[model samples]
Target: MKDKKQLFLSFLMIVVLALMLPMSALGAPGNDAPPDPAYAKWGRIAVQEVKAKYPEDKVVDYLHVGRKTNNQETIETFKLWLEGETKEFGVIIDIHFDTDTEKITNIQFKETSR
Candidate 1:
């Protein structure tokens, strides 16, 4: 009877201790793994433009060149490296959007031969 009571008390203490711990300590989301950074709207648009223009090539790497604002317009630039069967090239994509409407104004892709 004494052993049974001791076992019951031990189990109760463990439960209390567990409840006092933080939810993350119990293996909640983002505890052991971090979420990936999301792409901006302009970034997605630039990638799609590159894919459409260079269907024969695959994008190997990319770099976001940041955004520039001029009065009522904003431009997002990205440098994307593409690989083809026998050549590798870099493309500079400029995505221009309206600041007030958040709509695309123009997209230009310039290829840099390697």
Candidate 2:
């Protein structure tokens, strides 16, 4: 009976620690709440930052920002600024929309070749 009790306690401790591991690993020491994604500042920042690298007209498609089609609530499968003729934008920039604000978190150049 004593062995069984010890084994059960060990298993419970293992399970508890397993649950805690993810939480601890996922967060920084002082962080309590997850970041907010929907802030307007987020989207504005993406456009402003990417604009420095490419012209606004060069920006073909990005969520959170206004779309040519004027549609909202879309992700991934959308219009993308691409190489028209000059290969100027050979790689389409992927703009990540913040989950909380529906704003762009950042922009990254796609690795796939045009």
Candidate 3:
């Protein structure tokens, strides 16, 4: 009877450990957050434009600075870091679009040290 009880307890412990292993492998529950933001579209465009302009450079990082709105236009700003053959630099891109229709109006790029 003692051996049987010990074996059952060992099996139960093994089952509990197996379940816990899978949960840990799946990662934390908080990691299941929502998708990208509204500015993701403009961010992609900014990266693409920078890539086109600097074909010799590789885009190493990206950051969405912020957004601004006027009477009829909205500007989505992004900063992209590029690694060129010579050195690394950052480009600030402003994508101006029609607020209502979302049509692109203008895209401006400025190189910056910060």
Candidate 4:
């Protein structure tokens, strides 16, 4: 009985920790980007999509370029940017996008920089 209780307690503790872990921290961001050579297809598509949307802007850089598997679907998370112009475009800008259908889903931008 004692051994069983201790084992149960240990298992409970592990479960709690696992539950508490943040989903975002767990590779929601691609840990090994520019992913592998195999995922090149997705990479090009990602960049092209962003470029098409912001034709005048340049791809400053991108990170956290990957996705997660959820409920038989995949979620993509990444950041993209545009070269802001003070005179022509106004200011340099960067934005993020999250996609469920292998396209952009949520987006955020860099408002200011130090």
Per candidate, the number of residue pairs that clash is: 0, 4, 0, 4
Q: Scored by CA lDDT, what does every candidate get?
A: 0.80, 0.50, 0.87, 0.50
2 or 4, greater by TM-score:
4
Taking every candidate in turn, the Cα RMSD to the unseen true structure, in Å, is 18.5, 19.0, 16.7, 18.2
- What TM-score does structure 1 among the candidates reach? 0.66
Candidate 2: TM-score? 0.28
Residue pairs with clashing backbones, model 4: 84-91, 84-92, 85-90, 98-105
Q: Report the number of the highest-lDDT candidate.
A: 3
Determine which window of 10 residues in candidate 3 has minimal summed lDDT: 25-34
**lDDT score at residue 2, model 1, on the 0-100 scale:** 83
How many Å off is the CA of 99 in candidate 1? 0.6
User: What is the per-residue lDDT of model 3 for residues 7-94, given as tens digits with 9 covering 90 to 100?
Assistant: 5587678779978986776687656545789999999899999999999998867889999999999999999988676776899999
**TM-score-best of 1 and 4:** 1
Can you write out model 2's per-residue Cα lDDT over 1-114, one digit (the tens) per residue?
686467558767877897998787777776665556543454555556556655633554344434221244323222244323354343344455544466644466552333
* Model 1 score (lDDT): 0.80
User: What is the Å distance of residue 74 in model 1 from its true position?
Assistant: 0.2
lDDT of 4 by residue, 13-90 (tens): 877786766453565765443336644555565567667766777665444556566564454445554454431121
Deviation (Å) of 104 in candidate 4: 10
TM-score, per-candidate, Cα-based: 0.66, 0.28, 0.71, 0.41
Per-residue lDDT tens digits for candidate 1, residues 11-51, read 67877786777555747655654344433667777888999
